[model samples]
Target: MKEKEILINWMEEGMTSIPNVLLKNYRRLQLNETEMMVLLHIYSFSQKGISFPSFEDLSGLMTISSSDCAACVKKMIQKQVITIEQGEQTGYEFYSLTPLWNKIAALFESDARGESLQQAMTEEKDLYSLFEEEFGRPLSAIECETLALWIDQDQHDPAVIKAALREAVLSMKLNFRYIDRILFEWKKQGIKTVEQAREQGRKFRKPANTEQVSRSENAVPFYNWLEQ
Candidate 1:
């Protein structure tokens, strides 16, 4: 085909326009340029009815090697940026971009919420910073997402979340899973505030304290009654 004809034919076929939001915030999703390009190519292929592309096919469209492409795909799967679902008719597993779309949709929703979104972003960022400061290192993307879900999906107040973190810190377990368990237990008990959390802690200790006092009282009762 002539260069002009090739250009015309390609244009006639159509174009791929990535979501601007995705392009703008790719780094926040921990996607490197190569990974982003690979994802974009996969999206293009999916749109063109090629849902599952081999590493060689992916590497053909870019400068990356098949090894690198496979690595990127594995990393994305680990981070939950991509998932594999069984294809209906073929029974083959295909990479699904639903998780990626969900993250992008969350970003757009946050953007649409205006000031509340800004405040939420600030609060969530601050919470991550606080956890990192306590843990003495940066949080992984998964850890950050876990914290965000606590606030957004679980409807846990930031103060209550902080309280749980504090409890974890004091207990010498400054990890996301430990904090998550604390929050889970608090939710089960309907503890929705920092004060309620403190009250619940006291309630748990109260029983032990009362038991200790009862044991002491019982030990002295026989001798004390005889003396009286």
Candidate 2:
């Protein structure tokens, strides 16, 4: 019964709640173990209705000296993890963790954006590999630059670019200039999808006059995309 009473007394002493996000990401926020402990002590004091705990009060709860505690608090303020705000009483101040929470929110947003960018990069790399496989050699720097221009500057869809590459291969052109001409012609015709490109190919296969039929018989099986 005496031990049970002691446990009840400990429970009644109250608890301090720390944010799980801060505990998980404190190191990433550039805070060392000692600095983290100092922040925890301040949080505990705030929970108990003490807005600002002195260096002596912090030091009593920590293993560090009072001077060291003061230094840690100063560094945290400089890092913008905490701020000293004016209190209700003149000449009095309190530590606020608003800046620290803002930093954590920014970090979360950056991580989410980073993930999206990484996935895009992975898809672009796969597209490059497909080009290398078709050409049977790694692309030259100029060739890679041309491909990037098609995607970034020309705003061509990757699927459409792949369809243009297939057309170039079928015509036995198998060169960057010929593939670029195909893409230019498709863009001028407002072709935006693989299906649209295939429809254009079907139209090219049908000869309107005897002159076009004679030319087709003289050349390879594929349509000459450059002539169009």
Candidate 3:
């Protein structure tokens, strides 16, 4: 009798898809534009089963010079965003983005398991400390309730809500109403993660949103937006 072997081949499978977390969080990883583009191109090629791409092959598809691509590739390798290995097909060097994806996945998992606003404030995260760090004072009771509401009723991810708070602080618009407005807009757009919220923020500079932001700055009754 002959022994049978089971094999699983990714190339035999269909289209290559990237995770949303990776796409949106690349900026958080501190990847520059060139490194991001280089990693993306390599990913595209790998999806098409092209294990190895020459510097010329990679640079030809973009307006960047081969030297620039080479530099970016080197940076990506150093940053562990990509890894090079000898492929079995031809024993030539190939690049892989598994390292990058692993880092992205770990981040998402951590966020998923991380504490909620209330738990963190009372427990390990010491969110009160964080709030003090940002606001230069301990959070008031109503402010604490607002944070809890953002976590509980709104079901907004805690990290995203925290990020919104940081954004409001940076914009000099720190207030419960302002933070609520930010959460509302994000919820309207179906943004559930910090990465999605961050990505949207990058594209959120428009006149209408600016007007809305101005309105959000006006003193409204606490939690009034929830009723509206």
Candidate 4:
């Protein structure tokens, strides 16, 4: 038989689809906004022939402080969410989401051994397939385990969650902490069924169902009316 082939769909504008496989790692690693931002920055920079950027560049681009950036980088490195390589810059480090990237790619070809991406990623398989293929290797151990655990817990793909995140970001520009909290809350509430999500929306709208009341003018004082 010929070797298995993998195909991923083209990225859509404003698509927030991150591989669902990373959710567990996301929580375990305690990946905050700055850290996640840095990883994504490195991922994007890699495309432009810049695989590793110093902490300075990362902080600068993400509009954060040097100390803050360094702290986040240290955390990512400690968690194995990213790898740091020394370079010309002080405290230089390189970061990548290699493990997450691979799991996303494997979404197309289900492995019978462990947690299956087949279920969570089926709806948005194309969205992540090629991305995984692009970042084939060089994954760290922590990321791999994190990916697997997250994949195990996820009944939904990152694609849908991303769309919701993007909408929330655009509307409220909430930080990653808020996004994670929201996802956690939604999952805890058993929002698996579409009908359940819809019903929740309906329930949420109940408070807004308040009837509009025209402003009532204050009654004029009796003495004031007499004076007039």
Candidate 5:
């Protein structure tokens, strides 16, 4: 293959990665904001032909457990956002995205109602500033509100929200939406104090089964989603 052809071939894995400063806008279903964002990040990383990151790699990079990553991958497979297939040549798993939404929906689909998510976002005027200050990037307005709804549950303290954001940025390697999910998790874990969070992190980091821990780490998210 010529250089250009080689580059093209490497990238033509039929892997459809949605790109942008606002890739999470494409997310849907009952997924928590973090799971949705994590799916996008994983898909984007795989689009570069990186293959799947090892469990340790994913855990460290995503600031979540390997099992949580695996569970999210399973849900992504269920959603048909991505599909995993055993590789014919390498005897490993390969993955691909199905709907070519950007080209298809972006061209043919129009919301004549003028009352879609996009419009709602446009109306939430201060959303971008609030999101960018927390996440280091602008969030379309409705996403900001969705995040706000999560973070504001039970307690609506701006200080709490800001502190959660700071901790997530430092420890989570998180995209904007994940701050909400982590806060939710923290709340459920009774992690109201810095000492509690430190203890929880240490407990989770203890060495465990290499196989099971890397496959389906969290059931709480699924249960919580189901209850919600």
Candidate 6:
């Protein structure tokens, strides 16, 4: 036979479409090689309009015995990976892969959430290191708890917290009480970004009624959040 004729014959033999996710994650789904092959055969048969192929039919295409094929199908049903339902109109039993697809989708969502949590933990660790470096001392347990509360309870952005720390340092306060006050004030004012914090500081530092507060020539102007 010519190559073209062979190719045409192969094309006419038809193809089976399987989800890439199913192929990649079959092992994770707890399907062994034989079981996976059985599922593939069932799917192929279904594509050809065989909704429920018998154990003999399944065994014919596989190296396993008919009894083994039946056992595998029973195990899959027990695992809730596949289900058999009777058609209402036709009254014929058919296999449904909805449970398997749902399991795969749930696994993907769980993996995404796990990745997000891991990223959040890494960012929190870096933020803690930055705080320790700026303070020139390790954070006390209470200080650590306070920082966690800011991120978890108050939902303060890490960048905004860093900006508040900068404000405290500029004022020569360099204390948690001062920094906490700055954060509280910012939150009350609905300030959520570094630019908004800077703008707030500028507005507060602007001289009122042409009366400037006296300070040393080298002193950097900083918002005294305690007085506010």
The TM-scores, one per candidate, come to 0.48, 0.65, 0.45, 0.32, 0.34, 0.83
lDDT of each: 0.81, 0.90, 0.73, 0.51, 0.57, 0.89
TM-score of 1: 0.48
Off by over 4 Å in 5: 1-18, 21-24, 99-228
**Residue 190 lDDT, candidate 5, scale 0-100:** 71
Using TM-score, rank the candidates from best to worst.
Answer: 6, 2, 1, 3, 5, 4
lDDT (Cα, tens digit) per residue for candidate 6, span 107-194: 8999999998998898889889989999999999999999999999999988888888888787788988998999999999899999
- After superposition, candidate 2 runs with Cα above 4 Å error: 1-7, 87-92, 113-117, 155-228
The order of the candidates by lDDT, greatest first, is 2, 6, 1, 3, 5, 4
Give lDDT tens digits, candidate 1, residues 81-157: 99989978999978899999898888778778887778877887788788889888888899888988999899998
Q: Put down candidate 2 lDDT per residue, 18-84, tens digits, no spaces.
A: 9899999999899999999999999999998898999999999988999999999999999999999
For residue 33, give model 6's deviation from the true position in Å: 1.2
Error of 3 at 157 (Å): 22
| Better model by TM-score: candidate 1 vs candidate 3 | 1
Model 4 root mean square deviation, Cα atoms: 27.1
Q: What is the lDDT of residue 96 in candidate 1?
A: 99
lDDT of 6 at 192: 97
Per-residue lDDT tens digits for candidate 5, residues 1-228, read 699998888777566646552353444334566566566666666766766665565667677888987887777667655676677888997655544244335433444345555664553334446557665666777866666575345553444445455555545445544656656777787767756655554554444566655675652111121122
**CA-RMSD of model 6:** 3.1
Cα-lDDT of candidate 2: 0.90
User: What lDDT tens digits, residue by residue, belong to model 4 across residues 1-228?
Assistant: 323322223332223444455544454446776677767776667665577777687778878887877887777768666665565766655455565455445543555433454555563454244223333543356544433433356644455345334433433433334434545556777666545544553444233322321232332111111111
Q: Model 6, which residues run further than 4 Å from truth?
A: 1-6, 193-219
* Position 82, candidate 4: lDDT: 69
| Model with the higher TM-score, candidate 1 or 6 | 6
